[model samples]
Target: MGTTTMLVQCNCFDDVDVHANSVIGWQQTYDQLGAGHAHTTLKHLTAERFQIFRETFDKRIVQIGAAPAGRLCLAMPVCSSEPSVFQGKPLTGESVTVLHGGQEFFVQSPGGIDLLCVAVDIASLETFASREFSSADLCQLSRITRLDLEPAMIHRMRKHLERLIDNALVGEALSEAELEEQVLEFMLVLLDSALEWSVGRSANSTVSTYLVKQSQELALANQDEPPSVLDLCKHLNVSRSTLQRSFLSVTGLRPVEYLRALRLNIARRRLRSTETEQLTVARVASDLGFSHLGHFSGAYRTLFGETPSQTPRAR
Candidate 1:
């Protein structure tokens, strides 16, 4: 059996402010990129169908914001110059945030490289997928969720969102039932994703997660240090057998391999996003604790599918 749900979409830039008072629950979600003032394009997204409420062509929105239905939220930003929490984090995961909550995505609208964001709502989803999975499972699955960006999933979801935007742009119409189906699929994907995450978490033993997480922290903290397997046992007080099992179970890599991957992943990011940084094959290999240069190149090439010197770097 599956839970039933529906979605209401609005025309491009349709203003939902007038009904702000009527719609008991609305979140004022808008962004001017650190601007504290209000933008004209704020939208009040709700579960109710939009066609019923909006009769005019959408041009009213100078800004758009969506809050959960039956819940009210105000759109505002507090200025802070602090670097983003994700500043040093690798661009491996597909990031998602809520419409009206403690975290709201801020983007430069009408299309900008730095401001294009993909928005998804988990609550709006419902479907029976791979039995029931737990929150921990989802968190685990979410681990690879970012690491291995599911291109197929991304393509499907992107198209769906594109259609919604297109429909909004052209004011396209759909049957009442069809509209519901769209929302259903949207929610199903959401749940499916969560379920995938759950399965990932539960796939490994509790001990594995702890060791992997700890090892990851240590690796990041001492990227230059060669924290050998013996060091791991000394710090964590676990035998080689336990450490090997945990590493193999969660990340499927030995400590050396894991460190190599981590180093390359970091170096790759620095190459792509940071200012002029020389990560020559030998330099990178040595930094990652690979004593032999030849082996490092082979591993790096195999892992990233690119030669060390060929990495695209930007200042």
Candidate 2:
């Protein structure tokens, strides 16, 4: 299947009894199951973003007042005492990971547990934000800025999320360039606020936060030549197994898988979406780490169910 990417959504797991876990890639989010993360005991009264994100990026219509719903918040990956596998086998720990969608949340359950989640599609978000800020700031914004929020922060968050809703409903209210700024600023505001709320949810919560930040930094640091599992641990100060477990719990992709998948996803999207001008499939694949076009094409076809071609428009 194509990498299942839900740009902006708020759906729950099937049965509504399962835990909120990792997001599938931007192309095939719903087709594949979310990455398996630790479970939580918190009860979510609502999980709007999960459902909304899936449809948002696909040119779907926005329902009225969804922005002002007061629940269209960011999400963080929260794990409970559930069985989760990373790399291969099972290990024990109530670990969480930095989810691209938003802050991790958990609430104590008196009887039944509720898990509410919200995450924005990174691209849709950048599309929206360019209206208000620069692309560079948007990069900073995507990092899930950690902070503590007071009542003031909460109010700010509500306002920003609402603006996104308004803009989403009316496409290009601003120029495309402007949309990037707006989306990045919005992401920055939400992530900063989420950190405030996460202060005491679990001890060493920041460990997960730091790991996520550093992990991504390292992952991209050498995109020309990414590191091995052992290399990542040596550089990041985590065990290979610990890092492996951490990555699996959140991304549903192993370290190598994460890098490869990222490369393939980028190549695929460019091949399909950016045909406004002629593009070289080979160039894109190489930029994303494909040394062998034949091998890469085979993998791309399997992942996207279509061959990379100079074909005009998708059906």
Number of the top-ranking candidate, with TM-score as the measure: 1
lDDT of 1 by residue, 1-315 (tens): 011332344433323355333332334433234223322222222334321122221122123335444211211111112212222232222432223222322322222111112322333221121123345644553332222235565546545644654454454534334444454444434444634543233334887889878878887777756565545655776644456567888888876577668877876775576434545556656666656565556777899998766777664
lDDT (Cα) of model 1: 0.44
TM-score of 2: 0.31
lDDT of 2 at 252: 66
Off by over 4 Å in 2: 1-206, 310-315
Candidate 2 per-residue C-alpha lDDT over 199-302 given as tens digits, one digit per residue, 9 for 90 to 100 = 33231445655765577777667665555554565577654435545666666676656766666776666766765346677777667656567767877787
Q: What is the lDDT of residue 219 in candidate 1?
A: 74
Candidate 2 local Cα displacement, residue 215, angstroms = 2.5
Per model, state how many residue pairs clash. 18, 54
Tell me each candidate's TM-score: 0.33, 0.31
Q: Evaluate candidate 2 by giving its C-alpha RMSD to the native, one decimal.
A: 19.7
